[model samples]
Target: MTSLIIGVLLVVGGAMVGIALDRSLLRRWIRNRDPRRHHPAPETRAASSRRRSARHAIEDAERRVESAEAGQLSAETAASRVEASLDALQAGLVLCDRNGRVVAQNTAATQFLQARHGEALVAPVIKDLLEQARSGELVTTRVELHAEPRRSYEVRAGPVERGGEMLGAVALVHDITEHDRIESVRRDFVANVSHELKTPIGALSLLADSLAADSDPEVAAHLAGRMQIEIQRVANTIDDLLTLAMLEDESGRPGARVDVGAVVAAAVDRISETAEQNDVKVVLSNRTAATAIRGSRLHLESAVFNLLDNAVKFSESGGRVDVVVEADQQALTVSVTDEGIGIPATEQSRIFERFYRVDRARSRSTGGTGLGLAIVRHVALNHGGDVSVTSREGFGAKFTVTLPLDSGD
Candidate 1:
């Protein structure tokens, strides 16, 4: 019985040892199969690091793309704004590269250069100026173009430098035609004034010498009368000149409300004596008596009086002078017509010029100042009105003054 019990104990111990070894092997296999093990493999760690690095690179590339698009948009906006500003300038502007090639030009530049082959004429001047300007100097040239309008152009150019380095050149073009025209007018006016004043002074000197030498009472009386006439002529001429100078100023214009009908009537009353002496009959037609306009009453009276005086002086004896006052929504017109020798077509345009006379002999005989028409023209212009004449030689003449209607009315 003892021997069998020993044998049984030994077999049981062997089976228990085998079962423990199998359980340990199953635990190791479970740990190896699970990827969440405490210690990961080297290859798994390396793969995880690579995936993270690739994801970060893609995010950086996306950010760069967005930034690049934004930069491009900003640059385009800035370029468009620069172009607009350059085009807005009134003076002609041309920008050239370092090689003197035209890189940019404004609308005014195109118009100025293309006006009647102006480009062909001015291109050579521009090239020369740019070449000179490359020496870091401001260069200028003026070209006189004898085109239909006879214009003059001045081109001024200079090198454009940044940080002491010349980059290119910029040019400005100006139209100086009007400036030259004004200078010419000034010269002519000075010459005309000198000649006009010298004539009366020479006559006065001759008449004075004759009066002093004469002894007979009848001859002395005649000489004295002639001297008085010349003196009066000089006085009249001086007065007209003074008036012209005053009229050039803004203060000489109309500054108050005036009645068209009353102004016309007053003018007629002032020239009544002169009209009688000339044996001319003046008939007044007051159609716009109720109309009112803004201007100086004194100036209006003077303007109307001069017009009427001009008509009566030019009319033949028994000839009638017609003065009509009419108005519309836009303007008021005062027309003076005379049954007199009409102005020649060729001479009519120059009638309003100061000291201009169509018939010098007639003007001298009638004691008329040649400045009458000029005064009329100035008055009309100062009052924001215009004066016009219509006539045929030897038939009749009509002077019409059109004054703008006040906007406040």
Candidate 2:
């Protein structure tokens, strides 16, 4: 009985141990299928946190890549726009390194900076300005470029800096050739006006004194007539000056549409009495009936009248002055050809200048103010045309005024 009882106890003990082993194996298999069960609660929480952090890190990396791409695109667009704006500017622009070497320049820089024929646009003035800029100085200067046609430029240069660090220098160049020319013209005009007025005023004063002192009525009358002629010349000069001043104004009248033929006829009519007095024949030849140009009628008439008057005044007795009007696609041309003592080739270029006279004595005798051709030139220029002359000394002369034709004409 004792042996059987011991055997039963051993069997029961072995069965309990087998049951514990099976339970532990089953727990291990469950832990292998789902790793969360393999560790303590704190360790499982830490692993879950690590997984979340890795996923967030991947999303952040993707966002950074996207942001970088956007920034790069925006930068490229901005750079392109800046380059295009720089190219469209008319003023010359130049960029230089801190060492004063050229890095970039616009097309106008080549023209206004005197960079023709492989010459450097960074002139001595520019170099000096760059040096000053690199030293943190803002500079502005008017520098004339050494070039043909003699251009004047206003240059402005300054430092290109960021965060107190200098990158290089930049310069802007503005052409002032037209302004200089106008200023010169204004000075010359004042001087010429003063000189011309003095001549007439002095002559008038002297003649009036002589008339007052003379006892004979005949001598007084001759002196008075001479004064009248001088007074007329003075009046004409003032009128021409006023016209030129009006033309120079920016708000001046553009002009009116007028028939070239009618202007020629009126001009000829105005000079008829003078022509007869000089014994010069005046003939009008119209090659085109439809010669039309847009311009001030009074100015046009004055131009033609001056030409005819000049021709008649210079012509010898019985010489013929022919007014020929012709037209082509580009222009309506009125040419006044005269048989007169012609202008020398050397003097021809300067004859159109205000107050310039080739033969001062002859001009005085004929009461020429020396501003007729000058007036004609300005009138033609205002009308979008020009005046040119062809002459051979002692042979004859032709003064041609060309006005641009209206599109329909």
Candidate 3:
């Protein structure tokens, strides 16, 4: 019985040691799972759940960090591309802070600002625009820059806003110099057309009334002759206007290659009567025999005839007019030289303008419509070429019309 009691006590002691060892292992597992928990204690299921939540929170934070880095890289790349695109624009673009200081400018903006206006002029103008924009007022104005070649720019400034708050102002500058020049030309042309048409129409009306009222045959004949001259002048003007309109048409066919020398000869023949009447001798030198240029035969003939007619009209009685057809590798040139009261240097640049005459009285007496040289210039330009003149005030004038040769030339 004593040996049985001792064995039973030993078995109870072994069971108690086993229970302690299990508790120690549970505390060790809790400590290993969550090292932040310093107190050694057996883990409950709630503690294990909290540890799992902490691990998930750490992993989520790492994922967000990676996502944020990617977003930052994308944003930077997008900003870089936006900046590059802005730099490529032909118009000047400038961004300013609310304080009216220049925040950013593209390469075109810098060069255009320097080339367009003086700093003294542009800086103050930009500052005022920025001030206006900062006040939430959209600003627009035209600034005329006085440079070597005068330029006109349209400036527009507006506030840049985000989330209903004004960030800064962006200003765009566009070069409108060509546009303004064209508008001015259009206005002048309208005025000139009105004046030119009125003069001939008025004369015709006066001459017609006089002829109808006159009973004397001699007086009636004189009035009729004057009326005919005025009518012819009006007709010439209309024909020239039509020719110029046709030449400027975009859909007009590329003209066929024609013998330029033959065209010159025909042009001289067409005006031979007028040359004889004016007592001016026309001398034609056709050095280039089969020289050809790309243009309409009728149009080319008209251009050459106009030049020859002008020479004959302006030349002195019995003065000589020379027509020379020459060619080079690239082009065929027809030069008309005449011994006439030549054009002044200051006036030479403007002589090609339509209805422009050096001597209005002489133009009227010679029955000139003042569109001859202008026609020649436009015709040459349309044929992929140009026309130029060299003249001195007292000396004679030489007009050169150069037409581009065909590719096979």
TM-score of candidate 3 relative to the true fold: 0.76
Candidate with best TM-score: 3
Question: What's the distance in Å from true for residue 102, model 3?
Answer: 1.1
Backbone clash numbers for all candidates listed = 2, 0, 0
Model 1, residue 48: what's the lDDT? 91
Per-candidate TM equals 0.69, 0.73, 0.76
Model 1 quality (TM-score): 0.69
lDDT of 1 by residue, 70-138 (tens): 999999999899888878876688888888888888887887556567445876777678777877889
Which runs in model 2 stand beyond 4 Å of their true positions?
1-48, 80-89, 111-122, 132-148, 154-172, 245-258, 276-281, 292-296, 314-320, 329-331, 339-365, 381-397, 404-409
Task: Tell me the tens digit of each residue's lDDT in model 2 across 1-409.
Answer: 2221111123464574222334555666777899556655997789989999999999999999999999999999998888788888888888998787889877777554575442344466667787888888899888665765466777788999989888999988777778887787668767878977888999999998998899799999899899998889899889888876676563433556688799899999999999999999999999997777667888889899989989999999999999999988778899999999999988897788887777878987898877888888888888888999999999889999988886434
Clashing pairs in 2: none
The numbered model that scores best in lDDT is 2
Residues 1-409 of candidate 3: C-alpha lDDT, one tens digit per residue: 2221111123474564222334555666777889556653556657888999999999999999999999999999999998899999877788887677788988767864565435335545666787789879899998887864577878788998889988889888788888987787678677767867788899999988887888999999898888888888889888888887877773543557777788999999998999999899999998866587666788889999999999999999899999999987788899999999999987887788877889989987887877888889888887888899999987899999988776424
- Candidate 1 overall lDDT versus native: 0.81
